[model samples]
Target: MKQAESVSDFYKRLPSHAPTAVPLDNAGIGHINVFSRETCSVVSPYSRRDFYKVSLIIGTGRIYYADKWIEIDRPALLFSNPFVPYSWEAESAEQSGWYCLFTEEFVQHSERMHNLRDSPLFRIGSNPIFFPDQVQLGELSAIFQKMQAEMASSYPHKYDVLRSYLHLIIHEAMRSNPAEHFAAYSNASSRVSALFLELLERQFPIDSPQVNLKLKTPTDYAGALSVHVNHLNRSVKEITGKTTSAHIAARIVSEAKALLQHTDWNISDIAYSLGFEYASYFTLFFKKHSGISPTQLRGVV
Candidate 1:
């Protein structure tokens, strides 16, 4: 996967005259920025972002996220996370919106905030687009309006208030978004399962000690594939008759055995190449699955 765009790059892409005082991300807000009446869509190249964004867009456009596309003819809210790549194309020239872009650390101080990646709005493979009803739209926009006001306020505890507002918006979105976003599970399961297997296979060979397995766990693969971890597990299990983690472990153990038998690299190097931080951890994992330690396997083979 390609590197995600950073919040600094995001600022540089904006118009030279974009408001410099809209709580720019590098300020004391801890890498969070807010904008209103930002008529231009500054997103480009259709790649992931290092920061998460929640946009209140009031225009007609096609939103491309992950492998899916959504058309919007009405006011909508969108959640874009660092885990997924996305971009937008406006069908109309006139655009009005509020957007808040913040890094994960900005709101990760609390237990609930730590689960941001697993939330309904930002979770991979979940519907991030929501078309609120007219009344709901007004309410949502009002919240953004307040956020803007709070960002520009002189209050010492404004960010604390901002956090509360952010929570409210997220909760409201999850509660109010329609349930029509789900596709047929059987169809979805097969498709996601195939993609998951392919992605799982692509990280193979571990040809060098310097190389690291990028997708080491089901959660890591879920983030890479832009699907919720539970959803990915369910789909893979239903389609393959085995848990996703089981498949991952089986493949890793297979490769470990082969590496042990074929290569003279030290166990620590092999462990590092296979995404383990320590040889002991990898040894434990290998012995648990193979009934022998890596050294024993190498000696026997």
Candidate 2:
């Protein structure tokens, strides 16, 4: 597992010709940046990001989202949110498309602030992949091209114009499959399950040594969300097909692997930050979950 990529790191990884003139705000809100897949540099596998991304990928590729692997056999539209960890692996050498990345605050100035996260494009667990037709692909491509041009221009209201273009791409995707995209939770169980997942993902990346995970068990999460532990467990299991504890453990192991591979922290410090009281107990837990010790993984990486 790789450490999550920050927006600044992403900019540094781009090709020499890729523009970086757009200034990012103090809140880490970047003006919309567009890239052509052919020109952009490739990223490592299992890499996670801290920003939102929308891509129109053409050619063959595989998308790893959460635990699911989605194969792209044709032109497709993909949406990735900050909460979900996803990576793209290209199967074919010939790839071409457009992708734009921006932060949640980039669109906050718009009147449709509340609807941004509520939209299917940014919703976790909702299918973010779509196979678009030739005509639809052309339309989406044109919007991205316009955005690319606008991002390079010094127009006074370029950011505002870019917001409309972003919404256009989103609405176009929603229109492609309104039924699936607009599906809403009609029951309390489903809503609770969504909330639990959101709360669970909020404690992720463990980016700093000072930022320790506070929610380690289902009961801890239920207390935070003001729900019964049993009800939370049942809802998570019913909707996700996995127990709440399984999700928590898997996420912890994932973060542990990232920390072990990417950071210089000692094993004891890493263990304590992850909520383990002792280094020996963390070793036992990590070996049980990953079949390897933290030191072993660090050496391999």
Candidate 3:
């Protein structure tokens, strides 16, 4: 399990089976449905590499993220970039939904569509769910239908057609999205959260000891942000619904897992590198949050 460190690290663990979900043999993209309630209920913890996901709620239930639960009252759009990890908890086997997965390259390569980055839906470091009315949902679904049609059809410019339809979907989403939802985060609490998120993202892909410069404590962040420790925690908790220590620990745990998975470093090396005074202490901390020991994660078990 990857620790939910930076927001990007959170995203990197998003799990989906896009390869088998899509029907095309050489096609790099496709869509599928993930429904859970009884046995396969929990989405668990996983990440994505090259694909981005957009989900439309067709069944009824809750969507969990950001330490809070969002009720999916109606059909709505949920966006997950390649950088986040998300999961669902099930009381039973009663959840269902449609999830669309496509490669960034495919979406960006098709000609004349609005850039995916411009859609406001695909922006990095932001995760705002957009709820649409009946009329708008109908329009958006039409665009998706057209794209699916183009994918299935044998046309000279099928890819181009799909791009055009996708552009329409994005534009409709932009046109219909509630502007205030995006704007509400622009105030004080949001700014602090944004800064913290940026700081968290910068610590990753640490290639060496020099790269692991000590972001040693909460005060290091509070001092840099020019706010009292209490005030920083208050604002962050207000906006994000999690405590400062939780975020910090989460970030450290996230980085620790990434190193364990992607690097050849030993436990002591990783522990000292993350600023732990003792390897045993680091092991305990990692196990507490992630439910597994680092050594076991490295497959030495």
Best-performing candidate as measured by lDDT: 2
Residue 128 accuracy (lDDT) in model 3: 41
Candidate 2's residue-wise lDDT over 162-229, tens digit each? 88899899888889777876668878889998898878767866656655689999999999999999
- For model 1, residues 189-297, the per-residue Cα lDDT tens digits are 9989977876775565455678888999999999999999999999999999999999899878977876676567899989999999999999999999989999998
- Positional deviation of residue 53's Cα in model 3 after best superposition, in angstroms: 1.1
List the candidate 1 regions with Cα displacement exceeding 4 Å.
15-29, 177-235, 239-301
Decoy 3 TM-score against native: 0.53
Q: CA lDDT of 268 in candidate 3?
A: 82
TM-score of each: 0.61, 0.77, 0.53
> What are the runs in model 3 whose C-alpha is more than 4 Å off?
2-46, 66-69, 88-97, 110-119, 177-196, 199-301
1-301 per-residue lDDT for model 3 (tens digits): 2333332332344433222333432354332223222223355443332356566555455655433356766677777655444444443345444445555656656545336643467655455477878888787666666665655566866666666665666566667645832565568878887777667655543445324536666678788888787877888898889987888898788778876775577788788878887889999999999999998887952
lDDT value, candidate 1, whole model: 0.78
Clashing pairs in 1: none
Q: Candidate 3, residue 177: CA error in Å?
A: 4.4
What are the runs in model 2 whose C-alpha is more than 4 Å off? 1-4, 15-21, 26-30, 44-46, 66-69, 113-115, 208-210, 230-243, 253-273, 283-301
Residue 193 of model 3, lDDT score? 78
